[model samples]
Target chain A: MAEPRPAILIVEDEPEIRRFLRTAFGVEGYRVVESATGRRGSIDAGTHKPDLAIVDLALPDVDGIEVIRRIREWSPMPIIVLSARVQERSKIEALDAGANDYVTKPFGIGELLARVRAALRHAVRSPSGTSILRFGNTVVDLEKRTALRDEEEIRLTPIEFRLLAMLAKQLGMVVTHRHLLTVVWGPTHEKDTHYLRIYMKQLRDKLEIDPVRPRHLLTETGVGYRLVLDE
Target chain B: MVSIDKQRKPPAHPFSKIPAIFMGNLQRSWATVLRMNLKRHWVGYAWAVGAAAACTFVGLVMYPRFDLVNVAMVYLLAVVIIALRFSRGPAIAASVLFVAAFDFVFVPPRGTFTVDDIQYLLTFAIMLSVGLIISRLVKSVRRQAAAQAALEIEAETERIRSTLLASISHDLRTPLAVMAGASSSLAESGERLSAAERHALAKSVFDQAQEMSEHVAKVLQMTRLETGAIKVDRDWASLSEIVGAVLARLGERMAAHRVIVELPDDLPLVRVDATLIEQALGNLLENAAKHTPPATVVRVCAQRRGEEVIVTVQDYSAGLSDRDLERVFAKFHRGSVEGAGAGMGLGLAICRAIVRLHGGQTWAERVPGGGTAFRFTLPLEEAPSAPLELASN
Candidate 1:
């Protein structure tokens, strides 16, 4: 296994949002590097080699989507774009530009961190073989396709299973609400991300240390949900 | 180079302008007519000889019966008439002839060729001077009026353009705001709603709003193109992703009508504005839907030609005329009277500008089998290979 602490890159230009993110990541016992512009943010992404990059689409010189594309050119590092622009076109462009995920602005801090952690975790999982996937007392088996909570097998409906598979595929990466809805349901179901809450509630009630304050099945709120593992 | 040295101007009195210059113009036209001929030709001897003969005859008959003052006045009238009607050469001849005749018959020495007094010489010169001044003033006024008329014409054209822009700018803004506002609100509405109600409402709001928005955008595009505002943002992008995104966003509308897409399995990447290109294609699709009947086949096909790709949207509906094809992309122009009440009427105009902004072309034509076909080109970029190609093979 790797070290306990992970370093993160906060590529947002907004001061308040950056401070909030830095504090959140710092509390989580991770090193946080902050960048204001897309160009500077991208360089920091490379040199610092942080576990994750949280980029905003609107920058003074370069667009965030372009920043994501450039970083994606060399590394398969996880990039989650933060844009105040809610245009569907920008979302697809960011995702297709090699960004791992996207979140619109006026977003919850929990969602941003959730996505940042999710993206980094997913990147780490993609290159290496599967390790024991645990969220609180719950454990998941990727190869055998199984799950257990507190030493008891957990039964999940097909929709719930697919949703878990998609999220687990990313591991800790922040999957877009649009992306998750589409994958769990279909392209036509992309707009119906509310379904995420119901299924997420089901997983949390059955699998988390505290269903009310779930440690593993975290709600990113407005972004999507994130699954964090605790030993 | 003229001097009114008692020899070349009209009489100073305003009354003299009409009698001595204007109405007198008909009788005095001979002098002006002769002067024009002289200025144009090398020899003007015939004109001079002609005026002298006419003056001499009048001087002869009148000189015998009248006294010196009476005959002198009559001869003086002949000199002014000759000066006004003929060249200066002829005028001087008539002046000399009259002076000689006045001295011979009407002076103290009657029938004798002698000028007893020289005061009469001043009279002839002053009369000639007045005639020349009148003719020159008329010509200058004509030139000034012609120049003023030209300035007025140019000013009128500028006024029209500004007026048209003001009305059109206001006209295009309102409906665009309504449509764009509606789409965002509908898309962000309540979630507990049933699928059918949600789908129908979302589709209706989005599709109709999009139609209006596209129309408004096209109208805005037309103005931007005219004002030279469309700038390109060139970058590399996956074609399939742009198409997928457009289709998904436009899905709320295209879903009702069966949208058939055929993109190449091995399509190359393209360099364009992912948003603007999608908007352009979106406008074309909207154009087809608005014009074509519902539940009809609307096919969006992407075909490759070497380093370029042609995206075609064909609708099985009544086709456009040759006249429509010629002016279809023009601002405020319609494909037919069919979709006359359609949004802002700028769909094709915007498409043309967006396509051009990408350094490509867009055009529409009648499909051979029937209906209308809209096509635009995208310069394709060759990627190493698609990830899909590797997986599928």
Candidate 2:
């Protein structure tokens, strides 16, 4: 028998959103489970054990946060939060509560699917087992701690290399400011977030095709950074 | 001697102890006091009577060791106490009673209203006059205290009113200015601008208009809250669902930040006005997103402790200073955070109002790990036997 398509669970309160997401994910050949309430969502998450789950922060019966907490208790399955534009707190809560990624509501289907795929890939792959990270024409050799773009050596400062490597370590997942600051500048300098921004700008200037509007080295405002590896 | 004889005619009635002019003035003042609203001061009059009776009893007990003059001073002390504690009418009544008690009880011929010595008449006049003067002084002091209180209250109201006006104008002008500038640019540069440039300008206009509408909505909501027009419509709601709906509404705007929600699965249903609470939560989230740098984590977590559900929104930005945290909920009080958006600063104020209306307390604190955390608590009664469901659209 052909390998079973990965099961994905969607817990959104709105019927229209549930329908829209169902259609969008269905076309991508993943089996989808729908739950309209947070209560039902948690129950479905427990029963289905889907490879990935997309939860809405607002729910009629229970909060999407509850669903995230419940799933996180037992499973490491990637949970992608679907939220509204104003729910920055809920988005961060979902992320810190073990949600792997999030897509804000009214999101383009292309972007949602892209995040879903990234989350699912992160779930399936081991961390940095493969020594190389590539996005656009840039190649980062993790083992050698060296980077090349368009076949030319890209000189990166020590701080830039550490920042880039930290993001590359996660590949597609978000790395929080606290985590980055602690790792790069040590625990005492965690409050010095400006250092991260300055170095991130430098990294983008060197690595991105357009530094002004970076694609691969993305900054998640008020959160941290995520490095997108284009297939 | 003939001119002096005409003036001396007034002194013919030597038996009249008070001059005619003084007697006439006293009568006129008494008439004015009688015409005043005595019924409104009935309680003060009663208190004065009670005080006079108590003083008379004390004078009777102390008359053995203390001289008659000392006992009279006790009556004077009672008059002063009544004057300070009661209205002007009561004070006047107390003064009259003090003189009567002193003459009837303490004067020689102790139990009778007769005075054998004509010199004692002078003592009675002095005591009565002093009592009246003390009453007047006490009344003036009370009036001054009340006037000062009124002035302070008026000043406070004026300060708030002007602050509101300034904040509304500035907030309204910002978006209005943006809209006008963007639209005018499109109008003036249509021929020279490329299609993309035109689209961008148009987009900016639309965004500013949307922002202005949101501001107007906040302002209106605040007014309604201040006017006591909003009634809390308490219903059992799923915390997660309300949070989810807010997230859905704020969808694209929160795209950059990583949002984490950590509500427990077994959290009991909370009685709250869902719409208002949702708006409050939305404001907090928007505030966090606006104030923090891109990609910083914003977290929402709720814990059930006893009968309260404590919900917190935490952000890992440069944490708010102690001063900012204290004033964050004051209307139009914006933080001094750099790169913070041009908000009218009503978000936190509105959140506080909404939460307080729900009988909850809201507060902001620095997160231990480097960010600001806003927390609010809702009192929870009993969880519904069945899980509360969101109303279907």
Candidate that scores best on DockQ: 1
Model 1 chain B worst lDDT run, 10 consecutive residues: B384-393
How displaced is residue B150 in candidate 1, in Å? 12
Residues B157-274 of candidate 2 have per-residue lDDT tens digits of 8998898888778778887998899889988988799999998997887677667778877888888899997877565455665676577667777889998888776666677766
B1-393, model 1: which lDDT tens digit per residue? Answer: 122422576456665445435555786689987677566642434544554565556756766675556655665566556555544555555556555655555565567765556775565455445434433444466668888998898797677566546645555555556556655655676465577766666555544544444444455566676688656655444454455546654655676576777776556557676667777787778777777767998988888887788989889877888898777776556556844445544667777888887777777789888988888888776543322212432
Residue B25 of candidate 1: its Cα lDDT?
Answer: 75
Candidate 2 docking: what grade? incorrect
DockQ of each: 0.03, 0.01
Model 1's i-RMS, to one decimal, reads 15.1
Residue runs of model 2 more than 4 Å from their true location after superposition: A1-231, B1-43, B64-66, B338-342, B387-393
Error of 2 at A32 (Å): 42
Candidate 1 yields a Cα-based lDDT of: 0.66
Q: Considering only chain A, what is the TM-score of each predicted structure?
A: 0.62, 0.87
Which CAPRI category fits model 1? incorrect
Candidate 2 chain B worst ten-residue window by lDDT: B384-393
